[model samples]
Target: MQEISYKQKVLKEAKRQGIISCWFFLANFAASFLIAVYKAFTQPHTLKQLQNLELIDSVITNLTTLAATIYIWLAIKKLADIYDTDVYEIFIKAVIAVVLAIFLLLALGLEGITPGAVKAVSYVLVGIGIYFFILWFKLNFALAKITNNKLFKTYVFFAIISAVVGGAIKTLAMFGFFEGGVYMLAAALSIAILYVLPTAFYLYAWTMIKEE
Candidate 1:
């Protein structure tokens, strides 16, 4: 039996991880699009029912993201071990930030929480979200340099555009700038294009990595 070099090991893991990531993203994106379209087309009699559906969708998306984050961290850790790079540290921090954000969001649902406290939590969550994006961009940039894969760079570009557009839509929705149906439809389109593009690029980028 012959021992493969670390590059081969990393590529094998990446291919496996890429398939998993691709499936997760596809599931998440499809679910989100379907729910948004349903909400846009049909009106539920009760607000609670609508809210419940949205909550379920959000939970599924967040769970998928968490799982993907862990897988990405593990893959990068292996690469870092082989290359003696520090990008895995960013993954560790990103994972921690995401978990903390999720926990804080859940805490916001507790009864008897003051409005001020809620506002503060929201601010913290926003900050954490921004930091996570920065870390994510840095991690991808580092991987792009390490692997010389333009797909990673392409992901970064589309990710930034997605973030900006999604953020704008959310902000406008908060201000009641659009009707419910309009907002949901717009959000669905945003998720379809913005979210799917980056994930697709990421998956393809993993496939592009090969040993020299």
Candidate 2:
């Protein structure tokens, strides 16, 4: 039997491991969501109104972290196919990326140096930058393993597009683009859509690249 080409092997492993990684993320999201609901329901009546904000924010952050972890695993799986690297190595790298991203955001948020006028803006920028960096690193590394091209470029392209879309939607919502008490829900849904859309696009791009 003809042996599988290196590219085919990497792609196949990536696909299989990607499925596992996605399932893991789904499980994490579900658990986080349940926890958020529990927290919301059991909280004080006065805090119940605030519960949605806190709980939903927590859920979104946790889901984002879970997704990052899975991407890191996918990257490591790809590397293993190419270099026979141990899974532990991938886990370490992924952890490092996630930790660094979180650290950056926390540091920026707590710095207390920026002026009040720009503090919120700075924090937002730091958070977005950290997230985009981790995502770009993970996706580019995985794509590089599959095809030795400029993976980072494509990753950044899709990432910026996603951010723009997400930001625009949030801005409009904040400016009363949506009426009624459902604005918060609209914002949350926009965030969810933003998070998934880019990943979906990247997956499609990767598939097309692999088929070539």
Candidate 3:
């Protein structure tokens, strides 16, 4: 039997780990959804009205955000296992990527270009640009440590894939794909599902592409 290369082994492990992490996220999302629904019923207002309750809304949002962050951290840790790299190092890199992205966005405002262009571009640049940077940083750093491939190239590949998935979701929401009282509930559910789906896909693709 031909011996599999270390890179291949790492890729295979990453894929398996990624898929497992996705399942964890799915479970968390389900739990969060149930909590959201229970809260909706217990509260004295409609869902839209509940959204205006800053304290309650903040609590719910923070829980969801924490779930997402933990999911990413776990995925990175799994990738680090395959790559033989320090998980802390990967995490630190992820943090740096986020900080740099924020600085860049701040710089954009400082440059004082037209207010109109800034208003339009700021959202896209800050929103999508920061997200891609984080994805690229994690994907490339983990992949390079495992595969001896160029980090930038792997980052580019991951960034493109992540961007397309994110853009599609945003486009759907912007077009009023879910509108109405009942539809608002449906929209909230859809948003939660959409959020989970990309993470699921990324995990699956990473497993498939990385040499096992």
CA-lDDT, candidates in order: 0.78, 0.59, 0.59
Question: lDDT by residue for model 2 over 1-212, one digit each (tens)?
Answer: 23457656666666555545545554554555555555545666556667766677677767766775676477556756655435445456546655766665676666555676366656666776666567556656645554554543575577677778788888899788986547656665665556555555555444444522
How close is every model to the real structure, measured as TM-score?
0.77, 0.54, 0.45
Off by over 4 Å in 3: 1-13, 42-91, 97-180, 206-211
Q: Model 1 — TM-score against the truth?
A: 0.77
What digit string (tens of lDDT, one per residue) describes model 1 on residues 15-130? 57755777687778888778767776676548897889889899989888767766776678777866656788988898899889989999999999999999999999999999
Residue runs of model 1 more than 4 Å from their true location after superposition = 1-6, 42-59, 166-185
> How big is the RMSD of model 3?
7.7
Clashing residue pairs in candidate 2 (N, C-alpha, C atoms within 3 angstroms): none
Best by TM-score: 1
Clashes of each: 0, 0, 5
